[model samples]
Target: MEPLRTVTVRALSGRVGTVGSGDGGVRMTQLNGKPVQLKEEADEPGWEVDPDDDWGIAVVETVGRQLKLRREAVGMRAADFGLAVGYGEDLVYKIESGKRIPRPEYLDKADKVLDAGGLLSAMKEDVKKVRYPKNVREIAKLEAQAVELGVYVGLSLHGLLQTPEHARALFEARQPPYSEEEVERLVAARMARKAVFDKSPVPALSFVQEEAALRRRIGGTMVRRRQLEHLLGVARLRNVTFQVMPTESGAHPGVDGKIELLKFADGTAVGRSDGAFNGRPTTEPKELRILELRYSTIRAEALTPGESLAFIEQLLGET
Candidate 1:
């Protein structure tokens, strides 16, 4: 009888391919004989293309065509090309058929294999933006320049403040369902938005989270614990002012839905709320004031910054 020992390997997943246990990249561990193969949660296979993105679609198709042409010109079949590039033939086909987005690494590999002379690699800039959802890219663009951001979310934590595990779970729980690829793409995009917190001067960020959003128990016990811990960390940031809106606080303007306000360094601002003005984004000063007033009220009703951090710490302790 063989006494089993666990071994771990770091690789990408979410795309089934030829790898450990024949499922692309598996983080195999914890077994008696053969290792228990587990999916690696970290890694974005570029991103699934948005159906509504005409420009993105065109770019993908053009690059894919170039890849197929280059491979053919080099006298390599899809399988041969896939082997040369270290990806599954099926994945290679998906990329060439424009059914899947080609990752940066894939482009680099393809460029080398097909001898495209850095032509394929240069497409990464366009491909990178195409990978994320259109709305996510737009929101990220707005966040990049905003000097102040005030956000209120009643049902869940804001994307910018979510941990990868927490964000992945949230996306996985969506209804009507997203494909495995879609989920990873979304999670990647959401996490990418967190880059706003890393800007040079850092933005003045404020978040008012409903008490229930904190207690919702997303992604199970460990996930909840980690989320609470992460939330506490973000809430403690010097530039961030976080508040917890207790259910006991009674009715408030934010009870209608989520609200987001971003004020730019140039004195321009954009505001949006699910409950107000049909949920369309607005730049008008009068409309912005209404949202501002509502947000102020919500912040007032929420637990103070110090109190919120303490309350979350208490929750984390229980978890």
Candidate 2:
């Protein structure tokens, strides 16, 4: 039998850490200045906060722990693993140290080398879900889980339904132009988010669009036509309800900002405001009551379901 390779472990900050024996396998040496047993195959990637356990660690810390454990168990040194994965040893160190985000490719390579089943893939999704700007990622998460989404867009077509051409133009128009690759990635991400529409239990989506979103022609005539046609097709989904907040409405709470109210299976609501990171994932009764009141007011101030549909048709005719 192969002899087990042992490595020194040290407590850093408040978490366990292990240093390689310049090879594969790790053994704990100390934790929090005291000796503690570190199992080679035990699941200790992330911490759950009970009063008895530590809390206040970000999810990223857990991911770093998992990567470290997996890397050591496979008997590969950080430099060797980096070689196999096409990255520098320093990058591997940074990732294992929880100082940087691991790319999907790095995670895949680690998974293969460590025989990690699907843990790496799952971690990829978790990391992506966490790293993107909080507001956009949160909206993406709620969108995926939502059985019904009420979207009110003031400046442009709802992102999920945008074509690649339109999406690129929109993204590039940011203060700085997005690189070609960034634009492609952004478009792909948007398209993937739209898959919720195709789920077996399709989400009920009601889009209350502003007249300006249609009239502005964001990507010019061809892109605008495609966007309009896409909107009409999405509107046809039996589960989907489309509405337009007309200019003629004079004024409404919707005019205050963009609103995305998601209704989950448990009757909870999550929402994003117009600005970045301006949202709450609230399930508390008091917060829910407040969101309910505000949403109801906004809905009332906007057109009724029937009237909104007619407004969409009116804009469609103008096109």
Candidate 3:
């Protein structure tokens, strides 16, 4: 296999700022302070919608154009402007060219630097609406359109079914960790996906969770207790079903890990697995069929929805 390529951002005076993977070979550029590394193959089909679809590109373009105009009006060169914003000249150029999305902080600093009277800062909200990383937005969109959804979770509560506190705790526990702003953005996006539960025509939702997941104290005693109580409440939903796969049900299909299958009204479907198919979500019928079979088997091995509620209650009482 070929070695991964890297890009090293450096200052004209010979100081490295940041290093990130590049498409095919090592490349060097000048930039200010360190910024997060950019992925080589940024867009993954089916995982994320095209940036052009959600006014993402247009918003970036507008913001970039405004920044450039303001900088030119102030007679500031890219390097000087970048220093004012605590970023690199290359990054400033990237943002101005609409090739990069400026972080909220970057815009705030730029606004102050250019003395734009809050104009740049005002773009933060618009940028945020279209700037989710990875496949989060796409997954949320699929969940929204799903007429019937089946889930098998081995380690944690599904995002849609989580309460705010539970979801916050989960995001906070991620490795490398997310910034406060990032955590808030993620939590808000996750919560927004729950709107499907209240749709005019309710969707059919089913979940099979490993027993261990229910017992795990993710966010301390009180948080765990509240989560259990919340689960019980959601279990009462008329259009939802919940089951607990006992630990004793060893050697189950779900041992491979989490699985999600969503069926839509138009006869199209999508499925995702943590263990198979390269872990990428797929819309292929054959892949969907396999995931459905595994999910069905996991559900079969789990306690009935009624029993699952009782199981949760038992755990709650123990807590």
Candidate 4:
């Protein structure tokens, strides 16, 4: 049995390949037990893909490269690494090839197994930085990557479900005007994040909304109606759960702020405390725990899924 190592090799056998491990885009190889160092090879495969300019592709490829490098450094083949990480070899290949984003558990195992010095975890933050709207970048990135999302929206609609008309109205209300082009770019990016809804093994989504959010006419009657309809459609998704916190229910923990909790396949969790207009704020362990407790408390106080939908329908009928 060859000492299994996970590395992105250059094939060295024709068709030059790019080297990398996970999100870092840095590659490593070994020659005679000595770690072979690789640079940011502009000549590596997919150099033409332009990681810097294309936020999503660049971040995805970077993570894949990092995973490949660290795996090889440990002298493990993709199958061996996947087995250790409790994933199928095919899944490992998908992650390394940038065809799939890794589940949180796989990344954690890789972190310890590869002795990656927290590089894998750091890539989560790096991807957030790549998305526009610097403030909600983390939320956008995480929402796009999460396998399950537990979210509370106290203000307006969540970004993913907001129609272009609603999004534009909200953005235009900003103190500083966003140029038409900037608005379009942001909207395009937001819509792209919704791809998660279509991801295979679609993530379980639970959205708890405040009654006020339902009443706030973001883009006027027509826009609000469309937004409500959209929510109705999404709530009906097989993997989605929708709840509403009634105004009559009285003061709850979320009264202070909006929050979103992302639970990855590995059981590790991260959270955000800001809305789309405000940049997404990362939650540390202590903070994440606090939010979790608050979320549990609030969910307990909110309406049931059946009641919530009826409530929304009642509101829609009124308007």
Steric overlap count per candidate: 0, 1, 2, 27
> Who wins the TM-score comparison?
1
Model 3, CA-based lDDT: 0.76
What TM-score would every model get versus the actual structure?
0.70, 0.56, 0.61, 0.57
TM value for model 1:
0.70
Question: What lDDT does each candidate get?
Answer: 0.79, 0.63, 0.76, 0.69
> For every candidate structure, what is the RMSD over all alpha carbons to the true structure, in angstroms?
10.1, 13.9, 13.8, 13.3
Across 1-319, the per-residue lDDT of candidate 2 in tens digits comes to 2233343322132233465676554433443466443333222211111121122125556777787877787566765555455555555676676655566666887677666776776777766554344336666887888887877778888887687678777988987776654555566567657768877778788777777777777778787777777777777779887766667777665666777778888877676555323554555667645555655666666677677656666766776
The local lDDT score (0 to 100) that residue 82 gets in candidate 3 is 62
lDDT of 1 by residue, 167-281 (tens): 8888788898888777877887787678688888989999999999999988999988888888888888889999999989999999999999999988999999999999999
Ranking by lDDT: 1, 3, 4, 2
Best candidate according to lDDT = 1
lDDT of 3 by residue, 51-158 (tens): 444577787888898889878776777776665555556667778888667667878987877777787899987665554544676777778789999999998888
Model 3: runs farther than 4 Å from truth?
1-134
Candidate 4 deviant stretches above 4 angstroms:
1-131, 274-286
Better of 3 and 4 by TM-score: 3
Ranking by TM-score: 1, 3, 4, 2
Stretches of candidate 1 off by over 4 Å are 1-43, 61-128
